[model samples]
Target: MKLVVQVKLLPSPEQAVALEATLHACNRAADRASAAAFESGLFSRNDLQKLVYAELKADFGLGAQPVVRTLKKVVDAYTALRAAIRAGTLGRPGCVRRVKAESKPITFRLDAAQPFDDRILSWQHDASTVSIWTTAGRMKHVPFRGNADQLKTLREHRKGETDLVHRNGKWFLVATCEVPEAEQYEPVDWLGVDRGIVNLATTSDGHNHCGRRLGRYRRWQARKRAELQAKNTRSARRRAKRRTKREQRHATHANHKISKEIVAVAQRTGRGIALERLDGIRDRVRPSRDQRAALSSWPFHQLGEHIAYKAQRAGVPLIEVDAAYTSQMCPRCGHTARHNRPTRDSFSCRRCGLAGPADVVAGVNVRNRARSAWVFVNTPVPQGI
Candidate 1:
């Protein structure tokens, strides 16, 4: 499994200046490369490199590898933009969002993170320092720190490229670690998880991680955002952007906490985890106008990703089952209908009169599906007669 370990960098003032200058130069070169790619329709890495490599190397304050990284970054940005448009998540062909996105070349922030390979960056784990290439020159012996576990992971399993990131007022080096996975054990049973807006997750075991408090927090943030937008002042706009980022961080923190707990419980009990395949959830479900705003921006996908990665790291078996009618179907009598869920949080069977919390019942259905699916996966077919 691939895990990201972030360590805080402590650099001298002179080193910081060189680092910032290098990042700015790289991003400026990337902007120019992106413009050329957009205007000339040369989106491939090779094509873009051939066109802009000499220009960036001569004009920008960057060496050979930095120029190459800048070109590759431009190509990657275009690739992602194309994919998002094709995936229908952005909108249809004639939609305003699609038109706007296609109108201009992708741009990067001046302080955007840049990838560093072994050729340009070297780590000294024993000294807790790194030496990296900079616009001024090669800056050596920049100290860094991290938690005990993070340091251990960095020393033992760090691999591939590292990213030099500047966030808020802190510098961080995000290292990729190739951690070996624990051997997966045979599961006693499946622990089904139901994801939603009101309750972030509800398991078949009757554990619910509610989102009411987070919902209130987000709503308050939204209201402040609206006010800031209405003001239309420079400081107001800046504050709004900061608030938005803070809100995202809070939501992400909540997701991490929830996923860690769920994975720990599943691993401790020697059971597999079951989740719904939420590939196109936004298109599938309909919500009231009042609820639509919350549903649209809900971090359900992030929660699922968190659970998945944590499960992988813990060697817990995980399965994703079809989510259709999970809440509406009666687990006791095998009845399915919309009427079964008269209220958002409650469920009742029309024919069998079996009732339970709607989210828990949905989780139970997911567990049942996973139990059957796992058996089928491991079962072998008899030889043809």
Candidate 2:
């Protein structure tokens, strides 16, 4: 399993400015490379990287290593942009073009041997200071500090796939890890999950996961945002930055807890979990401002990811089914009719007069669909009884 570990970067003022400049330059180069590729029929990522790396070295007077590193960064961004385009996520091509124009000059990537990694000592909790290894040698340990709770997060980077990023005047580490493929298991029972804005999630088995806890945090965030907006002073802006960081930390902690609960529940049940293919839930939901805020705050994708990884680890299966008519279908009669689901909260079948909670009905439908598919696929049944 590939995992990423992220730790804080303690760059000196001069180094920080230099790094920012490099990043901006790399972003600009990537934009140019992407545009060139789009215009020229031969715009493979390699071609773009080669072109940009040479340009940075000759035109910008960057060293060979930095030039190569920056080109890699540009390639990464290009990959992300292309993916967004392929996914139909880049709504405005013009916007992408414009962003690319500004991006080429602003962002860059660092090599694994870059001075950034040499300073830190394997990222331990007890060590209060870690140095960034630079070409000049190990930088002095800057008195870096974070809350004790963050220590737990440091240990999560088991696979060391974390990325170090400098953005918007701050440094951040992001970890990306792949969930291992699950072992073959017998498919007998399935648990369906219904994720939403209001309640967060409702399992097919009559369990409800509430978003009210996140709602409370949202309210607090709103207050903080308003407070920041009210003040135009530099001090207020600085304070706002600190507030934003604090809120992000708290939100991440909450998500970790919620995700852990979801995985725990799935593991304990020892059954496959079924979820809707929520590829475009944002557009489908078209929620109100308050609703959207709450929905955005909740980490539905993260929860799903957690469930998938944990289930895989525990040898449980996870199924993704079409959500189109799951909410409307009558679980009793398997009838796909609009009249059966008269309201958002309640499902009543017009043909059979079946009544039940809309979410519960949807969950049952999801479970049934997944089970039917599993049986049709003839996936191996788990051993034992």
Candidate 3:
């Protein structure tokens, strides 16, 4: 499994200035390269580099590797944009967003992240410091700190390029690490997870990670964001952006905690995890205007992602089961009806008189589906079936 460990850089004031200049110079070079690529319609890495490499090195005071990295960044940006357009994620062809995106060249911020290879960046794990090449000069012995696990991972499994990012008046290096997955055990059963807006997650075992508190926090943040936008000032907009980031951080933290607990339970009980296939959920549902914002902004997808990675790290098997009618279908009598759900919170079966919390009922349905699905998945097929 590939994981990224972020380490905080503690550079001296002079080193910080050098790093900042190097980042700006690289981004400026990238902007120039991107403009050339757009005008010439040449975005291939080698082609683009051939066109602008000399200019970037000579004009931008960047070294050989920085020039190479800058050109690669421009190429990657266009490649990603093309992919997004092809996937229809930017909207259909000739639509306003798609047209606008295709019409202009991609641009990077002045403080954009810069990638460094081993030749340009050297790490001294024992000294907890790094020596990085910059436009100003090579800065050596710049201290850094991270959690014990992050430091250990960086020392052992860190590979590939590390991105130097400047955000919120701080510098961080995100290093990629490849960690081996533990051996998966045979599952005695499955733990189903139901994801929803009101309840972030509810398991088949009847444990719930309620979203009431998070919901309130988000509502408060939303109200503040609206106020800031209403003011229509630069500083107000900046504050709103910071508030948005804070909310995202909080939601991410909550998900990590919830997923860790769920994975721990599954591993201890020798149970696999089953989650719903929730792709295209946004396209499938419609809600009132008031509910639309909340529904659209919900972090249900992030919760699922957290659960998946944590499960993989813990060597717990995980699968996605069909989610169609999970909430309304009765686990007891196989009765399926929209009327089975009397309210958003409660579920009742008309045929078998079975009842439970709506979310739990959905989770139980997921577990039942996984049990049957696993049997077919693992059973060996006879010669010709």
> Tens digit of lDDT per residue, candidate 1, span 247-294?
999999999999999999999999999999999888887888998889
Candidate 3 wrongly placed segments (more than 4 Å): none
* Alpha-carbon runs more than 4 Å astray in model 1: 94-96, 350-352
Cα deviation of 187, candidate 1, in Å: 1.1
The weakest ten consecutive residues by lDDT in model 3 span: 67-76
Residue 271, model 2, lDDT: 73
Look at candidate 3 and give me any clashing residue pairs.
none
TM-score ranking from best candidate downward:
3, 1, 2
Residue 219 lDDT in candidate 2: 86
Return the lDDT, model 3, position 323: 96
C-alpha lDDT of residue 294 in model 2: 68
Residue by residue across 1-385, what tens digits does model 2's lDDT show? Answer: 4434455666679766654555555455545555655565343556766656677656654555544444555456556766776665656656865466435432334322222221132344455554433333334554345445454545443343334476556665454434455574765588888876556677788777777777787688789877887987898888888777777777667656665676567667677888888886777777777576666666778767767766776677788988888888887787778888777788898878889988888888888888888787886767994
